[model samples]
Target: MNPKDWSVSQTLMHAAKIYGEKEALFDLKRRMTYQELDTESGRLAAGLKELGVARGDRIGICLPNWNETVVLFFAAAKIGATLVPFNPMYRSHEIEYILENSKPHVLFISRAFEKQVSLSQAASLVHHVIAVRFKHKGMLSYSEIIDRNEKEMVREPIDVDEDVFCILYTSGTTGMPKGVMTVHRSVVQCAFTVSEEMHCNENDVFIVPAPLFHIFGITCNVMTAIASGARMILLEKYHPKTVLQLIEKEQVTVHQGVPTMFLKELDQEDFINYDLSTLRTGMVGAAPISPEQVQKIRKEMNFELCQSFGITETGSVTITRHDDDEKTITETVGRPLPGITVNIVDENRKPLPPGEVGEIAVYSFGNMKGYYQMPEKTREVLDDEGWFYTGDLGILDEKGNVRFVGRQKELIIRGGLNIYPQEIEAVLLKHPEISEAAVIGLPDDVLGERACAVIQLKPERSCTEDDIKQYVAERIATYKVPENILFSSEFPVTASGKIQKGKLKEQVLEHINA
Candidate 1:
C-alpha cells in the first residue's frame, strides 16, 4: 500500500506489521516495541471512543517527550480525533488562550506540568482532564484510559486529506495564536519522503532532543521513525551531556535538532568521551546556522548534517540530499522535496527570477488545510490556488535550491521555536505601567535571537527592568519575556503615530551597543 494514501494510524499499523517485536520507542529507561505500541494505542483508542471522543473531537496533549505522548498521537489518529499538542512550558496566560480557542473535549497533562499549570484551570475549558504519572482526587489517570477497555474497537475510516490530524497553535502577526490545521495526508507524505531522504531503515536508531510539540520533532523524529521502522530514543528534555551519552549508548544513527542543541553537545567539556561514530545522517534546522557552525557540525559531529527549511503551515518541504557537497550544505537550504513546488515571488505574487530575494511561496498537497476558525486570516496567506505565500523572505538559485534571507513578518525564531513579536507586544501593552510597546529580536549566539522590549512609559508611571520582566513573566511564556527591557519617554513614530519597529530596533541596538 502507498503511504500517501494511508492515515497516521495506518502508518503505525504498517510499521507494526513489518517490524513487529522491534523496539519502536524508548523514553528514558522505559521501552516499547512496535507490536506493543500498536496494541497499547488500540486499547487507548477504545477508551477514548468509550468516553464520547468521537470523530472530529479535539484532544489536547501538553506533555514533554515521553512514551505516552507517542501512544496518544497514534490513538487520536486511529479514532479520527484531532490532536492539539501544546508546549508544557506555557504559563496559564498562554495556555488559557489555546484552551478556549481549541475547546478540546479532552486534555492530557503530566503530574509535573500539573503543578505548573493547574488542572482546575484546564478543567473549565476542557471537558475531561487526564493526568499522566499522577492520580488526583477527581482527575483521570493515563493508565486508566489504557486499561479502561481491554480490546480494540472498530474505528471509523479516516479521510487522509479532508480530516484534520492535529491543530498546532502558532503565533501570528495579529497578536494571537492561530491554530494551523495539519491533515493526515501531509504528515504521511512527509514521513515517507523524509525517511527516504535520510536513507532510513529498520536498523536505524533515531534520537529526538526537540520537544514533541514542535513540528520538527513530530514529523522528523516520531513520524519519520514510524515510516522507516526506526528505533526511537526520546529525551525527556535536552541536555548537552545527556544527548551525547544517549547517542553513544543507544548508537543513534539518525538525529534531528536545532543548531543550539548541536552546539551544546559539541561544547560539552568531555565531548570526546562519547562514541558518536554510529551517527550517519540527520537534519539541522528551525533556526539560522552559520557556515562556520555548519562546518563545525560536519567535522565534529561525524554526521552528514542536512539543512532544510519548513514551517508549521507546511511540513518538511525542502531538504538537502544526503550526497550533497560541502558548499551546497553550507550555503543553501537545499532543493524542494518531490512534487513540492517552491516559488520566490514578489510582493505582487509574481514569481521572482533566480537570485532575487522575495517572499517564498510553496504549493504542495502537504500544505495546511487552513487556520482553524480564522478563515479571513487563512485567506490572507494561503491563496485559492493552494499556494501558501510564506511570509519568509528568500532567494532561489538557478539550481532550484532555496536560500533563506530573512523574515518579512517581524517574527522571532528562538531555539527553533516560533515566537511572534506581536503576541508579546500585545501582552506588554496590557501592562498598566506601559503606554506603548515594541518587541524586537536581537542577535544571540546561543538562542539565535533573544527578545528585547522597547517601551515608552505613560507620564508619571514608573517601572524598572525587573518590574517589566516580572509583570510580563506573569502573563506570557518565559521564553517570550524580553531579555532586555529599555525605557524611553517617547519613541520614533510616523505622522499617523504608529511606532516604527524598524527604527525602534535600530535605536535599541545602538543603545545596547553603546
Candidate 2:
C-alpha cells in the first residue's frame, strides 16, 4: 500500500500482519508484541464505539507513557475519534482550560494525578471520565470498558484519509494553550519523514524519554517506530539511572530526547558502568543546545547525534542527518525535509537573503490543518500563501542550514541595540564552570530592557559573578554582555524539558522586589 494513502489504523494493522509476534512496545511494567498491540487496540476501538464514541467524536487522553497509552492512540485513530492528549503533569487550571476548549466527550486520565487535577469542573462537558489505574466513585474504569467481550469486533468504515486524527495543545509559553488540529495525512507524512531521515528499520530498537503527549514523542518516536516496524521502549517517568539501565537492558539503539535528558544521563556518576555500545544514532532537540553538550554527546555517547527544529504545528521541519559532520550537526538544524520548504523572512513577510537573521517560515505537508476553533489565532501565524510564520528568529546559511537565534519575544532591546538571548547564553555556556545557562531580558527604566544571565554551575565548581561577566565581555560587544548574573540550582522547565524563560523572568522580578 502507498504510505500516503494509509491511515494510522491501516499502518498499525499492516505492521501487525507483517511483523506479527515481533516485540513492539516495552514499558517496564509489561510488554506487547505487534499482534497483541493491534488486537488490544482494536478491542479499545470497539469499546469506545460501544460507548457511542463515533467518528468525529473528541476524546481526551491524559496519561503517561504506558502500554495503554499506545493502545488508546491507535484505537482513537481506528474509530476516527479526534484524540486530544494532555500533559499528565498539567495542573487544575491548565487542564480545565483545555477541557473547556476541546470539550472531549470522554477523558482518560491517570489515577496518579487524582490529587493534582480536579476534573469535577469539566463534568458539564465530559460525559465520562475514565480512570486508568484507580477507581473513583463517579468515574468509569479503563479495564471495564475494554473487558466487554468485544475484543475482535471491527470498527465501521470511515474516511480515514480526510478525518481529523488528533488535536495536540501547544505548551502555551505565552498564554492559554491552543489546540493544533492535525489530520492523518500530516501524521503519515511526518512518520515517513522521520523514518527515512533516521534510517529506521525493523531491527532498530527505539527508546523514547520524552513524554508521549508531545509531538516529539508521538510522531518522531512512536509513529516513526510503528512505520518502520521497530521495537519501542517507553519510559513512564524519567530517572537518569533507570534510563541508563534500560539502554543496557533493552540494548536501545536509537535514543531521542531533549538536551537536558542527555545532560542528566551524561552527568551520572556511574555513566561508564552502563553498556551503551549498541547506541548508534539519536536526536537532541526541543530546546537550545550548547555546542559543548553536542560534542560531549557524540564523543562520549558514541552516537551520530542529530539536531532538529520543529513546532507542534509542523513536525520535524528540519533535521541534521546522522552522516553530517560534527560542526554542521552542532552548528545548524540541517536543511528542510524533502517535501518541506523553509525561508527566512523579515517583519514585512518578504524572504530574506541567506545569512541574514529573520523569522523562520515553514511550508510543508506536515503543517497542522489549523488551530482548533481558533481562526484568528491560526491566521496570526499561518499566512494566506500557505506559509507558517514560526515566531522563532533564525538564519538560513548559504548551504541552507538553519541557525536558530532566539524567540522573537525573547529578543532584548537595550536602548537601541537588539540582543539575542541565545548569543549571550552560548557565550556563558562556553565557560568551563557554567554547566547550563539561560539569558532573559529584565525591565529597565532607562534602557527599556537589560539582559540578565541565570546559570547552573558544574558540580563542585564556583566562579565569581565578576569573572563570569568578564568572560562574555571579552567575546561579545560590551552592550550585549549581561548586566546582572545570578546562580540557580535549577531552572523552571516544561514537561517536554524546555526552560521556562517567562517563569525565570518572574523569579528575577520577585528577587528584586524582595
Candidate 3:
C-alpha cells in the first residue's frame, strides 16, 4: 500500500499483523504487545460505536501517559472519530472552556483530577463522562467500555488523505487557547518524517516523558514509534531518578524530552550512577537549550542529540541530524524536514534575506487544517497562499538552517532598540552559576519596555545581581543588559515543559510592586 493512502487505523492494523508479538507499550501497571494493543482498541471502538458515536464525532481525552491513552488514540482513529486531547493540568475554568468549545460527545477523564477540574460543571456539554482510573458517582468506567467482548470489528477504510483525526488545544499564552484541527494525512506524514529522520525502527525502544496531550509528545513519540513499529515506554509522571532508572531497566534507545527535563536529569547528583549506555538517539525541543547544555548532554548523557524546532501548528519543522556537527546541532535548528518549505519574512510578508531576522513562515503538508471554528484567526496566521506565519522570530542561514531568536510577542524594544529575549537568556544560561534563565520585557516609562532577566541558580552556587549584570555586559552590548535582575528557585512551566515567560513577567511586576 502507498504510504500516502495510509490512515492511522491502517498503520495500527499493519503493525499488529507484522509485529504481533513485539512489545508495543509499557506503563506503570501493565505492558502490552502489538496484538493486545489492537484487540483492546478494537474493543473500545466497538463500545464507542454502540454509544452513538459516529464518523466525525469528537471524544475528549484528559489523561496522563498510560496504556489507555494509546488505546483511545487508536480507537478514535479506527472508528473515524476525532480525538480531543486535554491537558491534565488545566483547571476547571480552562477545562470548561475547551469542553464548551469542542463539545465532545464523550469525555474520558482521570478520576484523580475530578475535584481540581470540577468535572460536573462541564458534564452538560459531554453526553458521557468515562472515568479512567476510578469510577465517579455519576460517570462511566473505562472497564465497562473494554469489557464488551464483542467480536473484533473490521476497521473501515478512511480517506486517510484528508480527515480530521484530532483536535489539540494550543497552550494559550496570548488569549483563549485555540483548538487546532489536525488531520490523519498530516499526522502520518509528520510522524513518518520524524521517524525516518531519527532512524527509528522496530528494534528501537522509545521513551517519552513529555505529556501525551501535547503535539510534540503525540507526533514525535507516540505516532513516530507506531510508524516505526517500535516499543514505547510511557511515563505517568516525570521524576529524574525514575526516568533514569527506566532508561537502565528498559534499555531505552530513543528518548525525547524538553530541555528542562534534560537539565533536571543532569542536575541529579547521582545521574551518573544509572546505566544510560543503551541510549543512542534522542531529541531536545519545545524550549530553547543553550550550547553549554547541548555539550553537557552529549558529553555526560552519552546520546547522539538532535535539536528540534517546531510548533503545534506545524508538526516537526526543523531538526538537527544524527550526524550533524556540534556547531550545527548547538547553534542552529537544522534545515526543514522532507516535504516542508520554510522562509523568513518581513512584516509585509515578503521573504527576507538569509541573515536577516524576521517572522518564520512555513509551507508544509504538516500544517494544521485550521483553527477549529476560528476562520478569521486562521486566515490571519495561515495566509491564502498556504504559508503559516509562525509569529516567531528567526534567521535562516545561507545553508538553510534556521536560527531561532524568540517569539515575536516576547520581543523587547528598549530606547528604540530591539532585544530578543532568547538571545539574552542564552547568555545568562552560559553563566556557570545559573542553572536556568528567562528574560522578559517589563514596563518602562522611558524606554517603553525594559529587559528583565530572571534566573535560577545551580545548587550551592552563589552570584550577586551585579556579578550577573557584569557577566552579561562583558559579553554583549550595554543596551542589551537587563535593567532588572530577579532570582527564583524555579520558573513557571506549561504542561509540555516550556517556560511560561508571560507568567514570569507577571511575577517580576508583582516583585516590583512589592
TM-score of each: 0.82, 0.97, 0.98
Residues 13-127 of candidate 1 have per-residue lDDT tens digits of: 9889998899999998689999999999999999898878989999999988999999999999999999999888776787888899999999998877765667678888888
List where candidate 1 sits over 4 angstroms from the true fold: 172-174, 410-514
lDDT of each: 0.85, 0.88, 0.89
Residue 394, model 3, lDDT: 94
Summed over model 2, clashes come to: 0
Kindly give the number of clashing pairs for every candidate: 0, 0, 0
Instruction: Give the top-scoring candidate (lDDT).
Output: 3
Task: List the candidates ranked by TM-score, beginning with the highest.
Answer: 3, 2, 1
Number of the candidate with higher lDDT, 1 or 3? 3
Q: Model 3 scores what on Cα lDDT? A: 0.89
**Candidate 2: which stretches are off by over 4 Å?**
151-161
Q: Positional deviation of 255 in candidate 1, in angstroms? A: 1.2
Model 3 lDDT at residue 214:
89
Candidate 2 lDDT score at position 422: 95
Question: How well does model 2 score by local distance difference test?
Answer: 0.88
What are the candidates' C-alpha RMSDs? 10.9, 1.5, 1.2
Best by the TM-score measure: 3
How far residue 494's Cα lies from its native spot in candidate 2, in Å, is 0.6
